[model samples]
Target chain A: MKSSIQRVKAIVFDTFGTVVDWRGSIIRDLSAWGECEGVKADWAALADKWRGRYEPEKDRVRTGEIAWTNLDELHAHALDQVLAELDLEALSVDHRRHINRVWHRLEGWPDAVEGLTRIKRRYVIGPLSNGNVALLVNMAKHAGLPWDNVFSCELFRHYKPHPETYLGVCRLMYLDPAEVMMCAAHNGDLAAARAAGLKTAFIPRPTEHGPGQKTDLEPTQDWDVVANDVIELAERVGA
Target chain B: MKSSIQRVKAIVFDTFGTVVDWRGSIIRDLSAWGECEGVKADWAALADKWRGRYEPEKDRVRTGEIAWTNLDELHAHALDQVLAELDLEALSVDHRRHINRVWHRLEGWPDAVEGLTRIKRRYVIGPLSNGNVALLVNMAKHAGLPWDNVFSCELFRHYKPHPETYLGVCRLMYLDPAEVMMCAAHNGDLAAARAAGLKTAFIPRPTEHGPGQKTDLEPTQDWDVVANDVIELAERVGA
Candidate 1:
């Protein structure tokens, strides 16, 4: 296999499940808020169900089923749908808005911050997520992820797994795709980036969807580098 | 005068002279490169002349006289014009491209890194410059500016001193204009930002255009905050 590691100058990440523990953070946040509001359901189930709506809503924008919308707005829309689905429509608008911002308050993986800090010293490191710019920026501040920059679907007006989002970052950085590495916890995200001529690194987040998660537990394809976590990924990159 | 300092949640900066020393850095880079290539000219004069074309070229884009183009392309166009004007056409194309990237390798002002690091503890900080996204991102990496996010004219598709660029950042951050402060070394940049309803801070860059720089050496308007440098600006902002 060709070692493209030496050629990589920038590493852009998929933020949600890669850098931040969105599933656990959201479940804890909503469960606490739900208890206070006297609303009860299988909170973990709701968390999983809520996340299940994420990509489909974004797909609405990607496929032009809806107008171009940001991830926060999409999350809000998806939240409403899930609330109605669970028969919990009594949640107030202000509460709903606050809950929608849970994505911004996500806790980073234990190694995310220090690993990113180390790798940042050697390469330009930043989020290349489907999240909006404000969401990613706020999360970086909240989680202490020292990103050199923030790239978002809002910047490209295209959702990830789409070629535009992947290629647009390279265009913005004035770099060839091979010189940029797309690092993610999801095998699918890495596969898409690799197909787009970019270098790829996969780090499995087996519990990203909770302990029973069946997919993305291992690199499904031959990725450029597969590490245990960001810390190991940083070591692999010689940072 | 109203004290809007307490209301500010984010601070966006005008980068060129405010944060990075473009003139000195470019002059030093090109002078060393020129010596190596056996090229000869008054490089300082060329640097000043090249900077003189900066706004007018962006103005062409702003006015639709030229199609929307990135700062790198505009810089290249300006460099070609200056090279022709100075009769220094013997420089190779590769070397000229390297010279154009000098903007990316600019050194930060003496107080820029520490002051920004201090202020960032209390606020969201980033460049709101007319430079493209990659340029600002590269400069932050080059100078250790510790920006929480990177904003650019390329994101808004509008140049600074334009309402769109100022208002665009507020839109991305989901912030009211009053809650975001525009900080710059240039009063005109502050003036433009203020007219758009944002708070403004001016920190004079006396030697931005070299020691004898005559303009923007002091605040000409009743800016919301006036400080000697970013360190003082951070103090005024309660960081």
Candidate 2:
């Protein structure tokens, strides 16, 4: 809600569907892998359901309803349940690991690399994601995403929406929260970042959940900046 | 001594003086800043002396000979002594901070960026420096060094050649020691890394200490790969 543009020095992103097209990328990747491995299932549905578990599972740990767990752990747990529900037979640990790494091979949105390159010329740009450090690192390498650093929930042992998740990045970068901006396609993410005293930029990812995506179809709250895409966001922020 | 290159998946560099010419960069930066600020001193000598303090000071913290200190604190300690020796009068905290950040604006060796980019295409290339995370991150940005992550001694709260420094990187990256190679211009650093079971590559910076530099002019110990420069190192490593 505030336009204190001069205060921001770094911008952290929500990675899953904002910087990268997780839904479409995962569907294509997993489908190809499934075809190669001769394993068949409704991977699109499974990918959506897997993402759906991300928040609730993370909330369980964050709210102390369950023990603290990393995104990798939560993903594994969700993967087990979904695989069982899909009537997939027992798989080896190696196979599970390979499948879990599908998250690491995500393709960036078309504008992601170019916009981030422009933004990097001006400010520090990195992902503040629920993903682990290794996952984010591999994804950056795979997708050619030019990140100044990879700030992950793995660093703080806490997931996003937790104030520590945002504040931990500021601490690591040695910057004040006010000097760091959180840009996400999710309103809840920006809301959390705003409440944590960090500036917020929202870019709607209407198709984040595919055609029937209902929530986060539009900006739900007033943010410091709202852009049509990463390119526009960079231009608007003078990056 | 071991030529077992099969296990090394990532190669992390020691940033200051190893990957980048810290002495040259700092001396030049500080000398220019001194001229601008109407201050005078033996900037080159001071830069060299400050670099010299790095190991002995870290050894003090690492071996419990002195209290544990982060790089920023150690840098401040060295700064105070160097300032007195240079006979600089009282300066404001802002001025001191600006001077301290000479470390963040280091220039990489001629082959640093191109070699690193090549290596990065084949391996997870990052900095495992004694520099604090923010300092390393900023240095990378300023120098256009392509690093997948900035793994600093600050993360482990222990400076090299501490085993924890090497082990912590592997732990964070989810890789075994054999899966990570420690690449450095200094033999002492490679010695410690090899002792800790990590693979080693030596790319000598004979002039790191400026004219008449003696030590680390040649690989004192057998390193897995000995290259004259980073580009040669990249080629030797099949990057």
Task: Give the whole-model CA lDDT for all candidates, comma-separated.
Answer: 0.90, 0.87
Q: Candidate 1 has what TM-score?
A: 0.97
Of candidate 2 chain A, the 10-residue stretch with the lowest lDDT total is A1-10
Q: Each model: TM-score of chain B? A: 0.96, 0.95
In angstroms, the error of model 1 at B21 is: 1.3
lDDT of 2 by residue, A1-239 (tens): 23586789899999998999999998999899889988787989888888878877888888898876777778888888877777774866877788788998999999999999999999998999999888899999999999988888887888878899999888888899999999999999999999999999998888988998888988988788999999999998897
Kindly give the stretch of ten consecutive residues in candidate 1 chain A with the minimal lDDT sum.
Answer: A1-10
Residue-level lDDT tens digits of model 2 in B33-136: 88999877898878877877877778878789877677877888888787777677487688888888888899999999999999999999899999987898
Candidate 1 lDDT by residue in tens digits, B1-239:
24666788999999999998899888888889879987788989888989999989999998999888999999999999999899988788997998889889888999999999999999999999999988889989888899999889899888889899999999999999999999999988998999999999999889999977789887898888999999999888889
Assess every candidate by TM-score.
Answer: 0.97, 0.95
Candidate number with greatest DockQ: 1
DockQ of each: 0.89, 0.73
Fraction of native A-B contacts kept, per candidate: 0.92, 0.63
CAPRI band of model 2? medium
Error of 1 at A117 (Å): 0.8
Number of the top candidate by TM-score? 1
